[model samples]
Target: MNRPSILWKLYIAAFYVFLFAPLLVVAIFAFNASPFPSPPWKGFTLEWFIGNGSVFGKPGVLMDPIWLTTIGNSFKIALPVALLAVIIGTVNAWVLERAEFRGKTLLAMMMLWPLVIPGVVLGISILAFFSRTANGLEDVLNTDIDSLRPGLPLVILGQLSFILTIATLIIAARLRKFDRSLEEAALDLGASRTRVLRTVTLPFLQPALIGAGLVALLMSFENFNTTLMLVGSDPPLPITMYGQMREGATPAINAVSLMLMLGVGGIASIFALTSKAQQ
Candidate 1:
């Protein structure tokens, strides 16, 4: 028994090491003095974040216009996607959970179809559908439908197509566990449906809503496969980083990776605090 327990602990330890050692290396090399993100330690420096006013011919991630633009574009797409997905997902969850209608199971399955599809395939399908529609509209009415072309709008739409499903699943799972008696009791005690929902139901769903929103935000930020298909002139961080890496990127990419890890950690901390407060 003791030997089995010791082996199980070692297995868990080894699994975590396998998962996180690369991230650990990336974090450490973010501050490496060398321009490349490779070996020999190269001491430590913060130039990858701030740079030395361009005298050293290295602009760093923050100093680089392309990197900044990609980062900005990532935020622009992610914020809206998260907001829209959460709102729409909450409504879908409520409807699915509280209401029963004909073909309800089919409707639910249809709603979740996007989750099973590959991200690249989903992106391609969306692109093709929009392209056909745009071409038809142009040929018929000769209008400038540039907005429908591959860009952030399309990226957001593609992300939302699947992310909405994930958000719905998260919220709906929580909703399933929710006791309807509270709402019913509140209604019986002269509270309106709106009041019951706002005061009682929403409070109970606070954790799920936060979790859904956070998942949506991070998914949008890190998404690459779908974003790659829909991206046009402007690229997101993942796409930009992939391009830079293909062309032999500098250690500044490490800095960006560390920044992302820190950002994720900070967001997770806020989520923990919010959940605790709600409890």
Candidate 2:
């Protein structure tokens, strides 16, 4: 038993090392003075953090127009997707958890279909369906259909289709643990359903909704496979970074990655702290 426990501890240590070592390397390389993100330790520098141009040439930070625009685009797509997904998902969870119907099982399965489907396939299907539908509409109207073209709107829609399922699952898990007596008591006190839901149920589900929103935001922000198939000329940060890498990127990419890591880590810490405090 002692030997097995020792071995398990060593295994767990090794697992964490394997998991976090690469991230540490990337975090370190983000400050590498050299142009490239590799090899012999270059003296630490903040040029990459600010922007390559900040030290040597033109003045630009990660907040420069190009990078900033991509960031904005990512947020633009993610924010709406998160909001819509959480709202729809919370409602769906309520129905699935509290209401009974003949086809409830089938409906539940269908709602979760997107979670099981490959993102690439989902993206491609969405693209094809929209393209065919738009083409048909254009043929009927004899006009340009650029307004309904694949871009930010399609990205949001594609992300929502799957992300909402995630939100639904989270909300449903929380809903299942809820005390129905509170709701029943509220109803018995002559409270309207809408009032009961707003005052009691929504508050009860707040944490789950926040968790789902955070998850959806991160998922939308980092999503590549689905966004790739559906994006137009303008790409989000992940796609942009991928392009830069293919075109010979520098430590600047590492710097952006580090910033993202820090931001996400910070957000996660806040969530953790808040959840603990509530508990």
Candidate 3:
């Protein structure tokens, strides 16, 4: 085996440091004994991890319902979005891979449009269209419709616009590399299309589906810009965290962040191990 050059080693070290430095800081502060969440560490304490008060008293208190509800809302939005994205994206991937159609490139570009467009712009557009549509419905029916205001549905819609694209790309990449001979053999053996898909094609796509689902869930959970504009009264975790940060963040925020990071990391690690074992 060839040893890595000094420059290559330095670059790798720098990249690792860059990625982990912020996380290390957050983890450290989550246990900081100081009343203040920042520098000048007073001592070591785990009170913040248990949802204790910070230097800011009421504002710094952890494990508040507001934070919990925000997390719940995030999960509520993420679960549905991930499921829908996977379904739609899987179908899209299958179609694009198996069928040769006109406007294929254009359609592919359209699917990916959300990634290029700024999140704020997408949020505004969806909000405007929904608002206008809701108003028109109200005007035509002559009925009040307050439920359409920014909420879970709006958040889901906003996130789906982009997450679906991610799912499509992931599944499509897998499809492109798939061996069609197996599917053809199944068909030659008189298996129905649905049966072939369920038994053969789907098994191959499982890993990609799992990965896409995770990505979609994470994207929806951490989304802030679109959620802020489209989420009416109820805010997701990221929005709540942003608000807290704006209002002089408490150590509780760090605690919550630490918990989230750990949770996500644990889930991802488990998935990785499971996938490796299956392989």
Which prediction has the highest TM-score against the true structure? 1
Q: Write candidate 3's Cα lDDT for 137-236 as tens digits.
A: 9999997576566788888999999899999998898889889999999999999999999999999988888888887888888888888889878888
List ranges where model 3 is wrong by over 4 Å: 1-19, 51-62, 270-279
How do the residues 1-279 of candidate 2 rate in per-residue lDDT, one tens digit apiece? 556787799999999999999999989988778867797887988887676484645323374566778888889988998899899989999899989889999999999899889999999999999888889998999986864578988888888889988999988988998899999999999999999999998998888888888888889999998998899877888889889889987777787788889878876876677455434
TM for candidate 2 is 0.91
Clashing pairs in 1: none
Candidates sorted by lDDT, descending order? 1, 2, 3
Q: Decide which is better by lDDT, 1 or 2.
A: 1
- lDDT for 104 (candidate 3): 91
The top-ranked prediction according to lDDT is 1
TM-scores of all predicted structures: 0.92, 0.91, 0.87
